[model samples]
Target: MAASGHTGFKRIVKAAGYSWHGLCSTFRHESAFRQELAVSAVLVPLALWLGDDAASRALMIGSVFLVLIVELLNSAVEAAIDRFGGERHQLSARAKDMGSAAVLVSILNAAVIWLLLLI
Candidate 1:
């Protein structure tokens, strides 16, 4: 397999470190991420308490996490767009708009999931 660069526990640790770094960077640079994180902090615990069963809990929790994931992706897209420069361009605007739309959809998904699970 040509070593695959990293192996076993080392690969897991490295992946974890990268994931932590990404989370920190996203939290530091993105206000939207921070807001979502704050909301997740509250909702995740509530989801566990409010859910009637394991599957309901997972659905509620997963939906909230999905928002965080989408927000991170959107932040990444916006960062890449900014990296290209400050100049205005149609493509860059479109990319940013699309990333924003993805976040909105994820938020809506979370809302629907919570509502369905609760009622």
Candidate 2:
């Protein structure tokens, strides 16, 4: 159940606002996010043009979007971990490293998808 009592369209509107805030914040503070976004900007259009059919276009575009989604989640994880404090902790380090690894994997996934599709 939702705690805010918002339902239907109101809930969707609120959620969109929150999502926009997150995107803006990530864009402002996360250099990696910005870099990925820049790459995605180019790749998405290239996917549309290079794709042979609808399915190909969708798959190519989807792969790029997946990277952005993963990056957002990774940024969120790092932000939550950082919120705790500046003090070094094993768990915090592990969490951050894992987030970084996830981003790397997503990039590799996109590259493989593009390569297989284009080749």
Candidate 3:
């Protein structure tokens, strides 16, 4: 028989798989998500190109990952807003815009960190 933890392990894997699928779907439907993801996809490999040392590598990679994380959170907020009926409530607008702004700030943060660390 399978191990006792097999069921839980399978469930965790399925949930992670679903999350990745959702991220793909979200990237397709959400233009901003797609743009940020494209930026991040480029930045990761570029980091290894530019980052010749461990500290610079950490700075570059960490900053790029932060942008991705923020983008995912922004996508989550957008999905939440739409799921609630895509209403034009002021708070909803603020929430979504703030999420986007957070992403903007994250991009800026990456740039700043790169400048500080690499140049």
Candidate 4:
């Protein structure tokens, strides 16, 4: 057998489980994460309902997930920024703001995707 740490599909499953745990930890600790998760729950099912065709379904579902993914990344960045210091700094603030901007862009993307699909 190969010496890779991940033996096979089991490794993928284990990694995914680990990832889920991490996401859960963020959800519990981060208010923004919790909010995003709540939004995703509603949006995902609604997207499924709105998706009358294959392309629409994929677009809606994919866009919702993209927002969630971006939120997670933004939360991670904010955490890292907080860890760097409690003191105020221009660079740190900019970093957090940029991460926030990224998330906002992703949300807009999701909105556009849904709107276009529905049309």
Candidate 5:
């Protein structure tokens, strides 16, 4: 298992801080993340307004959030790949392309979900 230095409240606080740092880093460094966040900002409120029921609302909102989550993970993958391998290699290129593909798929998924919900 991983290390947990603090207990309960302190741990929660530390985690929140870490999360904030991650968000800031992603927003600052990742254009795709920023784009997804902008989409989420628009969709979340629209979901609350458009969804006929709680389940549908959750699905709508969750789909948008899922895109952001996937983008973050994809960004992390790209960052790790870049950090580990500076030289040009097929595997490194493939890894970055795969990460980009994941982000595109997530955006498509969110779009489909929204369309299905609205129509």
Candidate 6:
């Protein structure tokens, strides 16, 4: 019943392909995303070593993933806004700013989670 009319395993395969494309595009276009991904490369393994239990490990790793997710969303918003035009517009600026703020909040959330769990 999906809008694409492609159902069952075909839908899953198509969705996975689209997700991979988005990740590749984001990695190519966004330096911030690249930096965060680099940090995550270290953090995920550290989380595995430092975490005392399943819940703690999941929390640490999940928090790191959240940052990447938010950054992807922020990048998407900025891309859409940019596509409209280069001209300045108050609403467009606000949307971009809000997207940026969301990324910051996600990063802060991850930091707080790691700090709280570790110390």
> TM-score of model 6 relative to the true fold?
0.97
Cα displacement (Å) at residue 106, model 1: 0.5
For model 3, the superposed segments whose C-alpha errors exceed 4 Å read 1-7
Q: In candidate 4, how many clashes are counted?
A: 0
Runs in model 1 deviating more than 4 A are: 1-4
- Residue by residue across 1-76, what tens digits does model 1's lDDT show? 2266888888889889999999999999999999999999999999989999999999999999999999999999
lDDT of each: 0.95, 0.94, 0.86, 0.86, 0.88, 0.98
Model 1 lDDT at residue 97? 98
Error of 1 at 3 (Å): 9.2
Model 5: residues >4 Å from true position, as ranges?
A: 1-4
Candidate 2 RMSD to the real structure: 0.9
> So what's the TM-score on candidate 1?
0.93
TM-score, cand. 3: 0.84
Give the better candidate number (3 or 5) by TM-score: 5
Error of 4 at 83 (Å): 1.3
**lDDT for each residue of candidate 3 in 1-119, tens digit (9 for 90 to 100):** 24444566787787798898988888788887787778878988988888889888888999988988898888888888889895589999999899989989999999999888776
Candidate 4 Cα deviation (angstroms), residue 114: 1.2
Residue 30 lDDT, candidate 3, scale 0-100:
81
Winner of 3 and 6 under lDDT: 6
For candidate 3, give the lDDT. Answer: 0.86
Tell me which residue pairs clash in candidate 4. none
Q: Where is model 4 more than 4 Å wrong at Cα? A: 1-14
Q: Any residue pairs clashing in model 3, and if so which?
A: none
Q: Candidate 3 at 73: error in angstroms?
A: 0.9
Q: Which of candidates 1 and 2 reaches a greater lDDT?
A: 1
